[model samples]
Target: MSEQESQFLLILFGGIFFAFLMSLFVVAMVILHRQRQVKNRQKLEQIKSEYEKTLLNVENEIHQETLAQIGRELHDNIGQLLSLTKLSLNSAKPEKQQQAKEYVNQVIKEVRALSKTLNLDWVESLSLDEFINQQLHRIQATGFCETSLQSDHSFAELKKEEKLVLIRVIQECLNNAIKHADPSRIDIRIHQNGKVRILQIADDGRGFDTSQKSSGSGMYNLGKRMETIGGKFQLSSIVGKGTVVNLELPFSV
Candidate 1:
């Protein structure tokens, strides 16, 4: 080849190599940028998890405080009124006794209605079975669906916070089952084996494609609530088999 031609070819090869190095450098920078973004997202998730833990703690304290206040009110005002009405009835004359008895009876009825204050502090004194039973009763009172809870005696030994989360999670499960599944029968089962607590809610209804429906806030919240307490949440459903929400909590309160 001629000297000038050889020189031109060398320069062309050098330019191509430089362009190749530039492209490699650009690709490396892009990859580094993506890694940084992923790291930031992980850090944000950690912060969010910590925040939710603190928030749940605060809410629990508030709920306990409110329950105490309500219990005091029921014992003080309602209890005193019922006592005073009973004493007044005891002193009334025979001619006036029937009228007095009716008034006292009405007052006693009001006091009993007010006594549902047990709901306010239910978690403090009741086992998980009782807590969930009361909630299921409330749901049944709506007459919208048939709800049942089956639990082991060991369920009451669960940590109060864990029990609270499970209770709320079950409610959300039932809500979804009713709203999305259009279920006629909703069943919740909870049992403890040693330190592990397993909970499941299932329904017989039109099932859904869970792969396409994983972004629901109710499902996300239940999962997050379980994670906060070191529990695992899982969901599975087939187009015709119906949905099952499963949870396992291994630690004690």
Candidate 2:
């Protein structure tokens, strides 16, 4: 070939080689992007699966607790009422028979209430505020401590699973206070600020140190449960002052 022809051929080959390299780069970039997408999708699926499993476990725990509570009520409360009712009926006096009739009616009411608890639907129907009030009432009924609830009554909507977890956690906190704190008063406050909803359970009990590692897994498990529902658990305490547990749930409206 002539010199100019050789130079032209060299230029053409260089241009083709450059274009081939560019095509290979584009292909590699596309493959890399696709692989990343697949990985992200798998990670999301795993997270979703774990969330669902946690929800199921929470539900089961609540049901089991409710059943136990029902058993106690039946044995402690209703059984006594029935025994009194039989005695009144046997007396044969008009007033005694009337008292027995009233006892029968009260027993019916109590039985109906217990039956409702057997179904888990009540968990779905109870609002967070209502649940707090009910729990406080139970504590107060025991005369172990004074209980109060301060709420705006405006609560953010929460999933049933989230509410169940909160209920269980609060129950545990109350139980701990009753068992160890020896507090004269237990207070619960619920409030909503924009997208954030908070529930604070405070007790004027003998508080413990939060800095030291807890020997029990209760606190750790409570934190993990809150994290699963995109909420936060914070407990603050002082030796003589009191202990306060703050549970925060942030959601978009």
In the range 1-253, model 1's lDDT, one tens digit per residue, is: 9999999999999999999999999999999999999999999999888857755764565466446646765687667766766766777577456656766777677666556553546556667677667656766776867889887765556666666676666666766777888777778898777878788888877888877856548677667778877888998888867888888888564
- Per-candidate TM-score against the hidden true structure: 0.56, 0.91
Native-vs-model 2 lDDT? 0.87
In Å, residue 225's CA in model 2 sits off its true spot by: 1.9
Q: How close is candidate 1 to the true structure, as a TM-score?
A: 0.56
Q: Top model by lDDT, which number?
A: 2
* Model 2, span 141-167: residue lDDT tens: 978889998987545477777777788
> Which RMSD does model 2 reach against the true structure?
1.9
* Model 2 residue 118 distance off true place after TM-score fit, in angstroms: 1.3
